[model samples]
Target: MTIKDTAEEWEVRATETPFKGNKTSVRTDDVVMPGGSVARRDYQVHPGSVAVLALDDEDRVVVIRQYRHPVRHKLWEIPAGLLDIPGENPLHAAQRELYEEAHVKAEDWRVLTDVFTTPGGCDEAVRIFLARNLSEAEGQRFEVEDEEADMELARVSVDELVRGALAGDLHNNCLVVGVLSLVAARHGDGLDALRPAEAPWPARPFEV
Candidate 1:
C-alpha cells in the first residue's frame, strides 16, 4: 500500500459558520463518524499561504523577526504571506513576499515543501519555496505598519538556524519547515530532484 495522505471527506450532516473574520472564518461541521455516531468539529478556514526560504551564495537564509500577538513573542521567520485570493499562483505570491519582507529577489526557485500549520485546528496550508541566486530588489522597499513596522531583518547561516531550531529557540512554523526541508533536500536525492517552483499543489490549486 502507498504510504501517503489521500484526500477523502467524511459525511457532513450539517455545517455552519459561527464567526467570520476579515481573511478567515470559524467553521463548524456535524460529521458522521464510524459506528454511526455524529460529532461536531470546528476549525478555522484559511485562504492558504506561501513562504520563501531565500538562500544566498554564502549559504545564509534571509529571516525576519516580528511580533506575534497570539503567541506574545517576537519569532524569527522566513518571508511568508497569505495567497490573497482564491486560486492565486503560489509562486508569484512567494516572490512577492520575498521582495516585500526581505527586499530580495532570486533567480532560481523550487518547491521546498508544503505543510498544514495546524491540521487539527486550522485548514491553513502553506507552500514553502527554495530560492537561490539572490540579489537586492530594485526600487523602494515596501512600506510597513503595525507589527510589521517593527520587524527586524537579517541573514543567518543555515547551521546557526539549525542549531537554534534544535535548541528549541526558533518557533515559527515556516522557518522550521523550510530549513529542515532544505536540509533534507540537500542530503536526500539532491536539490535538483526537488519539484519545480510551478509544480501543482492540490491543497491550493492555481493557474499557470
Candidate 2:
C-alpha cells in the first residue's frame, strides 16, 4: 500500500500531567484520517540525553563500569546523562558527564551523531560525541547519596570493544553507538587493524 500525506493531520487536543518521575506522561491528540474519519490518541513524551566517547593519548577509549539501577546489573558504558534542565544542549551535557562520571576532560571535542533512543512512544534523543586529548580532572558524579555505583576506567582496543558489544558483553547502547561511529570515522573501511586481541587494562580507574 502506498501512503500519502493528507491535509488533515494530527493535532494536540489536550495535555494532562505535565510532569512525571520517568517514562510516564499523559497527553491527548486529535487525528483526521484521509477518509474524513476523526480519532483521538494519547501520548507520552520523554526527554533527551547525551553520550561521550573519550580517547586518551595512548589511543585507548575511556569507559566506565557502573551498576545501572534500572537494569539491576553492572555493565560497561560510556559517560552519559539526561538533560535535567530545559534548553540544555547535548554537547554541553556530554562534556559535563565526561568530567563528572569519568573525571577526565577533553581538549578536542566533536559531535559524531544524534539518535533517537525510542521513537515509537517517547521523544527522547541521544547525542553522541568524540572527545580527544584527554587530561585528568575532578569527578562530579550524581548527587544522589543512595545511588549504588562505583566507576572503573578501562582501556581496550577498538576492535575488542566492538566484539564485546556484539557479544552482549558491552550492553550500553550509547557507548557502543558512539565508539563504533568514532572507529568508523577514524579508520574508514579498514577497521580490523584497530582491534585488539586481548584486554589491556590499567590497575585502577583514576586520574592519569
Per model, state how many residue pairs clash: 0, 1
Predicted structure with the largest lDDT when compared to the true one: 1
TM-score of 2: 0.72
Q: In model 2, what are the clashing residue pairs, if there are any?
A: 159-195
lDDT of 2 by residue, 1-208 (tens): 9994333335544446645666446555566656667676555665567788887777778887877788898888887887676665555677788877777888777666667775555656677777778988854544533342456667776778888988878878887887778767767743233322111212111121
> Where in model 2 is the C-alpha error above 4 Å?
1-9, 22-44, 138-144, 188-208
Candidate 1 residues lying further than 4 Å off, grouped into runs, are none
Instruction: Compute each candidate's TM-score over C-alphas.
Output: 0.98, 0.72
Model 1 clash tally? Answer: 0
- lDDT string for model 1 (168-193, tens) is 99999899989988898899999889
Query: Which pairs of residues clash in candidate 1, taking residues 3 or more apart in a chain or in different chains?
Result: none
Sum up the clashes in candidate 2.
Answer: 1
